[model samples]
Target: MSTERRAPLDRKRVADTALKLLNDVGLDGLSLRAIARELDVKAPALYWHFKDKQALLDEMATEMYRRMVAGTALDPGDTWQERLRKSSHGLRGELRGYRDGAKVFSGSRFTGIEHAEQMEDTLRLFTAAGFTLAQAVRATATTYLYTLGFVTEEQGVEPLPDERREGYDVAERARRMSDFPLAARAGAEIFADYDRHFEEGLELVLAGIAVRFGGS
Candidate 1:
């Protein structure tokens, strides 16, 4: 087939290859050139499909969102808390599924949507819980941020070697936890049983929203 007749690399093709590259190399090492190289094409060729790295990252985030949205219902059948919790876990799992996926989805204005497709999903949950459109927007933002922050940490994000090591299972971590009463008492609860911690956090955010809104 002629170069003109070459099948276009649609968004999925680009994202799939990018995802592999992400798994192969973390975000800092990722680039349009890397993706193009993986796909056996020139770096400029990627511009035909993605304007830039941010655009490609946005597409990748959208791919993860699509997967998350599929697991959580959009038909408004559950409690807002349930909906929100489901979205939170769905998103966390999506990010955990790919390499450097958490970094890609967390803390960036990929397309500067501050609110994206997942934001709509979150807003729908709020409105279902008896929130007005404005209230839904405001309230959902908090829960969304909380969810993203939780997931980012769940991916084992480190603030500092000494600071972040609290979650690590090293001997130094044990010695430090032993010295602090509260940290010692809560150590197992904090570092252990992530499932319980995530659920507890999910409940706290939901309850906060409820008390401020109506579900209490």
Candidate 2:
């Protein structure tokens, strides 16, 4: 019997394959050996392209960010606040696309040229809106961190179990929180639409920036 041979390996191919596997095994279950097996190559072969798992993960993150940034649209007519709002929403949508996507992307040290370019563009948005260079940098970093942190927790939330599904109803939640007046009062607001929550939180941050920087 003849043995099947695989194509030559490269960093991109490895990273792409790893991402597909990520959808299946998640970040914690992913391993170099598993990636190699998926490629039908020896595990040691991957080391030639990546020094270690972290290196591979970083490449994966770079690619993910690269694509996300590429897909983002910047409208010239939009005000800085509007631009920031659009960018924030774009980022949230991108991060929520994959399982553990935010966690994996956040774990990376974005040292690639694309990442540098993206950072530069983000800073430009703030600087153009009357912020000093330092302020722009901080604002950009703060927004990025906020989006990442929010999505990380968003994806981390477990779904309601079959047995507990019925108990999670609105009436049941209201009843449970009845004894706790404050929680009961805030229950509806707390469980409001997540999309709206993200939008409102982003607006608050942008509003603070506008107040401090004097942008329209």
Candidate 3:
């Protein structure tokens, strides 16, 4: 008889399995036990790497950030405005890549300093463009928050890319809001073409930052 030898368990392996299971079961259903089952190990095994569910979530969020940074390459020649736009777009793509991905990342802290390098680079970009240190932090944070909030709502509408929840139909929304003619008509503009809407909204944000911060 032949038997398969499993890879040794570690924090990365545990976090990786949890991220995959996250899509199948979602945040509420994701637990160390479920991850253990996927890894063919006991629940206690996960505790050795992660103290609790929140710790695992922190790791997962960090992993998502790591992957996003790995896949994105910001040109040194790009303006702060261009960098901000590209970074926000890249972040949105990463958050939308998994089920409840934004939710997983939203409130969790990174388990280590792996994210510090990226954070430093972003702050430097803004400061180089003439923003004060505080302003640089704020500007970077504002765009980050916008991307997070946008993707959170986007994922709420469609938990998985292949799956969209019901009750978002434009005609039905319009019918329900028939008494408010203008609001009813707004449904068509709001529910569809998220890509275009995201770009437009991002532009508005960038414009506001430029007006307020005097960045190029």
Candidate 4:
């Protein structure tokens, strides 16, 4: 036998592979065998580190949080508002890097310490703005819910197929779209640029928070 030591299987490599697989086949199509094939290893090799698929996915989510922290400063000099905006946009940009990454990383239970720190940063923001920890947590939760919900939808959009392209039946969709002028006119123009919407949502959150806590 050759006396060469194998490079230890790592969480980063595994997460990177999973993200690659996500871009290739999406959530429903991703699998251990696929990841193993991508890594040039047998399926059993992955088991040495992750135990099971869900465990691996959980680690991916954790890694996603760590990635957000790595990409952001959460700085001391920046006001809490600046911190929150940077953190959220950092995560949004990260999710934008791979297909359906937002869908994979969103929701509860899989979040690690880094994820908590995001909320803690938001808490610090609200606290600095003069709210208690409980209030800060609650306010941060609202912003987080909106952010995750928005990102998930955005990530899910690209994978949409011909069959799923709004059904192509304007008359059929008209009843559902009747009340919403914006949704009804969601042609290329509406989606080709999302810069305005992202800023608008962020502004709405900050404005709402300021109104609630600014007077104090």
Top model number, lDDT: 3
Clashing residue pairs for model 1: none
Query: Top model by TM-score, which number?
Result: 3
Q: Write candidate 2's Cα lDDT for 1-216 as tens digits.
A: 778766668988999899888877888989999999999889999999999888998998887877787888776566777777777777787767666788888868864687676567667766777788888777766777888888776665522111122343555678887888777767555454567777788888887877777754
Structural similarity to truth (TM-score) of each candidate: 0.78, 0.83, 0.96, 0.77
Candidate 3 lDDT, 12-114, residue by residue in tens: 8988888888889989999899899999888997888899989999999999999998998988787888888989999999888889999999999988898
Task: Identify the runs in model 3 with alpha carbons over 4 angstroms from their true place.
Answer: 1-3
lDDT of each: 0.70, 0.75, 0.88, 0.69
Worst-scoring 10-residue span by lDDT in model 3: 187-196
Ranking by lDDT: 3, 2, 1, 4
| Model 3 lDDT at residue 28 | 92
* C-alpha lDDT of candidate 1 relative to the true structure: 0.70
Ranked candidates (TM-score, high to low): 3, 2, 1, 4
Q: After best superposition, candidate 1 residue 125: deviation in angstroms?
A: 5.7
